[model samples]
Structures are given as C-alpha cells and as structure tokens.
Target: MNWIWISGVAFLLSFLAAGVLIFFGKELEDLGITGNIYYIILIPLGFSSAAFLAGAMKSYASFTSNESVSYGKLQLTGPIVIFALVVGGGFIMPNFNRKEQFDVKMRIVSNDRPMTTLNEGTVTLYIGKEPKTVNIHDGEVAFYNIPEKYHNRKVRIVPAINSYQLADSNEVLISKNEDYVDIHVTRTKESLSTLVRGSVLDQKNMAVVHALLDFSSGLATCYTDPNGNFSLTVPLPPGEKAQLKVVTDGITRFNEVVTISSTIPIDLRIDKTP
Candidate 1:
C-alpha cells in the first residue's frame, strides 16, 4: 500500500505498454509511430501517469490502512479510473499524430554509370516543394527529416551536379504511412553538340596521330589518319575556352586552347618544344 512502491509499478507498466503499442500495434492499425520525434511526448507522459497513479494509490490506501484493512469500493474506483485514463492517453497521442505521417528512404541510382566528380560534389534534392542542394558521395544519399504532412504528396527529384544530368526528371508518389522509395535515375553526361576537328603533328611535320589528348576528364586517344590529320567531337565544358593537352612520351606536352569559332575543321599544329 506504499504510494512510492505503487508509483514505481505504474512507471514499469507504462513503459511496457508504450513499447508494445509502438512496435507491434499493427492490430490497432499500422499507425507507424515506431521512430519519430513524436515519441518525445511519452517522456513527460510517463512521469505524469506514474505520479497520478501514486496519488491514487495513496488516497486508496488512506481509506483502508486504518488496520481494519477494508476500503470502500467507491473510494478505489476514482483513482483506478484516473490512472487508466492518464496512461492510456499517453500511448495514444503519438499514434494520433503519426496517423498523418509517412517515412521516405531515397537512394540516387546512377544507372551503374561512373560519376565524373568535380570539385563541388553536390546535387539538388526536391522533397515536396522544398529544394536543397546536398553533397553526394559514391552517388548515394539518405534523408530522415520528412514529416507526416508530406505523405501522399508528389515529389520530383533531380540531380543538379555539374557535368552530370539526370537524363530525365524522376517523380515519386509518397504513398502509405511508410514509404520506401528507390529513385531510378540515369546519370548521363551533360550534352555538348559542337564538334572540334584538328590534326596533331611533330616538329618533323609527322602525324602525331597516336598522341594522347586530354580534354578535361574525358580523354580522347586521338591518333591521326594516314594524312596526319585527327578530328574529334569536343567534349570540353562550354561557356569557356577549352584546351587540349597532347601528352606524348619523352616530348614536352603540347596543347592549344581554342574556341570553335566555326564548324569548319580548325587546323591545329603541335609545334616542337622551344
């Protein structure tokens, strides 16, 4: 009949009930409140429920602890009913809030294609209407801050990383109280339609066709034709003058920075190192 002992028992029962409701409460409905900030409410509710149960036990004991050890039924009922309500409500509030929520797990699929990483390694993530540019490593990313309010909403995701394009925008429908999303995206190189044609030559005026041409990250093993002439579609990033370095063994590296002023082949001559 000690109120302190009774309060401890109440706390234990409340903890157990909350655990069961959160983990296996599917029979009540898959409220999906297993892991969320809403659970923080249970902390204070547990203490309040235990305190109420303790007070009820003290009041009930006062009626019967007169050595006659007989407490009127009506005296017991009030405390018992209040204890039930307090503990019961504590377990339901989170579920009520969760009834509006769903979870999202997003993984950016790069179609198994290798990503050409730049200095700024980042992409844009669109959650509902909010857009955030998040850094990505290994082409994988995850987010857990979604609220239940975003449930059943249409979400469009796109990668804004430079040198890479999503190929197409990916749209996903947020369905269910828990949504596991696998975003299918094909990371293709951002397109450049312009072509640059040229020839590589040595000091002897010989075709340096086998010369290795380094154009940004995309290397072109440009070997000259029989006439010592080589041409390639330029893959250099646009909006700036691009340079191609001719890397040959032993000889000093030769290169030229040129803008394709015309569609006609721009003749390039790799002069000997001065």
Candidate 2:
C-alpha cells in the first residue's frame, strides 16, 4: 500500500514536471531559442527514482510486522535498478553536447572590497576533445550544448582573457548531474587593472599639484600629489577608447582619447601655459 501511494505521488509529480517543461519548450521555440529533448525526460527519471526510495523506506517498517523477506527484497530492488540506470547511463549516454543542446552559462565578477561586476569576458569549454568558445555578457555568459557524443564524458572548462594565459578547471564529470554545467569565473585586479599616471606641471616646469583629473561623466577622479605625480585607476571598457578630462583654473586642460588594452600604466603629461 505504501509502495502504491509513493509511486502514485511520484508519477503525478513527474507528469506535472514533464508537462511544464513541454510547455516551456514551446515558449522557448516561439522565442527562437533551440530546445533540448533531455530537458523534458530527466524530471521523470529523477522523480521515479525518488518514488522507489520512498517505497523502500516504507517497506523497511513492514519487516518487523511479518512482511515477507521476498517482498522487502522486491521493494529494495526497485531503487537498486534506478540507481544502476543512473550510474550506468552516465557512461552509456550516446548524446553529449551535440545537436539539440542546452545552455551552459555562468556569472563573471571581480574580487574587490565590494566586488566589481565584469560585464564581458570569454571562456572555452572542451566537450570530450572538442573545444568551444562562449562569449560573456552583462555578468553572465553561456555556450550552447555540445556534440551529443560527448554527453557522458569528462568535460573541461577553461577561462582566459588572453590565449597565452588560459586557466583550466578540473574536468567536470557529467553523468546524471544535469543537462548543463554552469561555471563561475573571477578575475583579480592584477589581471584587469590599468594604471594611469603622470606629472602635472605648470608653465615653469614646476609641479602643478592638486590638479583634478576626471574621466567622462565624472565616473572616476584623481588628483596630483605635491610632487605633481598622480596615479589613477580607470578600467576602460573592453575593446574601446575612452576620454580623460583634466580641469585646471576652471578650464579644460587635456581631453584625450586613450586605449587601455593591458594591465599596464598609461603615462600622461599635463602642462599648463599662461
């Protein structure tokens, strides 16, 4: 009776899950994003396994109540079969990242006092031996599913701003884990810092200290020290040029377009003339 009750509940839940996924699939298709078949079936697989476990737990109580050994064994065998399938199927699944794939996505951030959000970056994933690139955007990025043949194999995920400094994570063992692998990548300030430094001098070539430097929109500002040396940090948007505005005596001094493509200091000379 317990087995019947658990199985009944499991079947209902699995059925509802399948229906919801199927509904979402149509919506996704309407949105023009490709859908995967596994998305709908995996729910049933998981819930059915859970149902078996529930039955086994209920049957254990029957053991002390004169329940037959054979019946208990039968109850246990159901779960064992599901577990075997989950474990065995990990290696036997023919489809991996091939066609009809799912999205593998993650967020990108910087390790700072308050944590800076990295809006754009790129990562690479190896499905089996095949490598694929995923473009990052607005704090998250994804690579659409891989070739199906690599579905049950060990997958490699790597992130590198430059091809020469690529870093790899331990190969992800994907069996019955899920249809997608979400990965998070963090970049230290050392990896993305751009130091802007220069000496603010006056007409006499003397130091013009305490001069104000502003980036467009006044998003960032820095001031020259007594020695006319100023150091500022402004992360130029990836792959773009930005302007730096300096103000002296309520007048615009230097408004120059600069490119910061590396983790190096950009030098500037600000001299005021009468």
TM-score of each: 0.40, 0.35
Residue-pair clashes per prediction, in order, are 3, 8
* lDDT digits (tens) for residues 1-274 of candidate 1: 4555555675666567677766665332323344432254455455545465556444342333454556532344544455555556656764675645334554455554444342345555576555745556555444444566667777777666554555554667655554455555543454443456677667777776566665654544465576766667665434435666766664646666656432556555667565
Q: List the residue pairs that clash in candidate 1.
A: 101-148, 209-223, 209-224
lDDT (10s digit) by residue, model 2, range 224-261: 88987888766643334677777788777788976654
What are the Cα lDDT values of the candidates?
0.55, 0.57
Candidate 1: which stretches are off by over 4 Å? 1-37, 52-57, 61-83, 93-101, 112-154, 173-274
Q: What C-alpha lDDT, on a 0 to 100 scale, does residue 263 get in candidate 2?
A: 47
Model 2, residue 183: C-alpha shift (Å): 10
Using TM-score as the measure, which candidate wins? 1
